[model samples]
Target: MKAFLDILKPNQLIYPNTVGYDWNQVDVNRPQGHPYYHWLQTNQGEGVVNIDNKSIILSKNDGILITPFTPHKYQSDQFWTTNFITICGYASIFFQKQLGEKKYFVLRESSCVDKDIYNLTNKLDSSCDDAQISLQTYKIFLDILHGVQQVSAEGYKSIPICWEIKNYIDDNYMEKISIKKIGRLFNISPQYIIKVFKQAFNISPYRYLTKKRISEAEKLLISNKDLLISEVANLVGFDGASHFIDVFKRVENCTPLEFRLIYYQGADFNHE
Candidate 1:
């Protein structure tokens, strides 16, 4: 793996520090961690992040913000690649307040802001003085924070019915559900439900349900390592482990066990 890092001296607006990447197949670990905030954005393949003993899976266009002195480690697959920036200052204080107490945030679909971050980092790299670098880096940090906030706000502004339907599916993914059932609950025809849902979410109701179930199953598999495959299948509304494995493989390009093993390699397991 290869990385390009740049560190700058501290200033009033921000303390700009390293911005770089682990090109591929890199084991990036910080047992003691850094004193400044770190924002890591993945551009390709998958990476596993362990922060304060919590594990997270990051894929393309996903980013994570980690706070100061948090024990964290990350590793990428053969094709995994990322760009990241580390910084702190008064702006960081505001960012932290906006961030709340959470040590990390997983940002999805951040490609739109990636270019700006890259450009800002390049500008910082070319900056001739401490004051210029600090100001530019502070702007980059603010942009990142604002971009995440905008994405979050947009997520809540989807059509009411579509949001309600998605919430319903998420809440009851363990049960068998159909378009007709959803339509009946919402007092709409199944055809209308399908049409508006597709328009709103870009996928059919069934696909959304499957994705919700699979996503929940992934969380369960990661957090509760002792759960049997069949148990996970049942929990996620699949009839059996075989069907669950098939769907998981189709969507993730890896079986449930394979996915689990890749992320939780040394964890103990209870087989069934």
Candidate 2:
């Protein structure tokens, strides 16, 4: 198994600084008791983390953020791929207060956010220049901190109607969906839906639906390999291939064909 550990340089602005990061398979059965704040996530398999003497079982997509000075150790019975980072500085002080005395908390399955972290890590790891690596590492650290804050704030709350609407769109993004239709189905006014949904998610319902459609279209373009842009657009609920191309470029900074080539390399294409 490949393992990566990076110790970051001191940064004057962002404190507390990230001391190091670890990404690899774990084989030891011992405590990881440390002094700096740690954010750990299990990417594959299962593990048990003991935080403050409390043993918590973590499976794939499970994560825990531990505060500085917390007593914690983690071990796995089977193959366990994990990613973690240690942080210290003034920023740690801020997180300490926001996290309260309990210090350790589990993160929900945030696939999108986790993808961002993985992409940033890849960028950091692949860069050869030290300056570029440092900049990328700092960006990744900040992104993880912001993600932690969002996840901590949203811990295990009742599912809101807006979330329900979002989930519905996620499941049926290939079908046309309108705010008015959603309002009628949920027994609410379109105006109220727009207002509350925006307040809760920071994006209007229509925008969210468009993003979902574009995301699905991107996935289809990559997975199907031979799929035409028009076919992908139609499959993702776009009115026309041209409009889909426009939206895809606007959201992804690249056209569908370009994205496919970038990920799939040499690929045959057919225009539908």
TM-score of each: 0.51, 0.50
C-alpha positional error of residue 222 in candidate 2 after TM-score superposition, expressed in Å: 0.9
Query: Which tens-of-lDDT digit does each residue in 140-242 have in candidate 2?
Result: 4545544564564363235477677777877888888898889888999999889877766666888878876875675576457778888898999999999
lDDT of 2: 0.62
Which portions of model 1 miss their true places by more than 4 Å? 1-6, 21-25, 150-155, 158-272
The clash count for each model shown is 0, 5
lDDT of 1: 0.71
Residues 200-256, model 1: lDDT tens digits: 665688987887787678667756779999999999999899999999877655678
lDDT of each: 0.71, 0.62
Worst 10 residues of 2 by lDDT: 12-21
Please report the TM-score between candidate 1 and the true structure: 0.51
Q: What is the lDDT, from 0 to 100, of the residue 176 in candidate 1? A: 86
**Top model number, TM-score:** 1
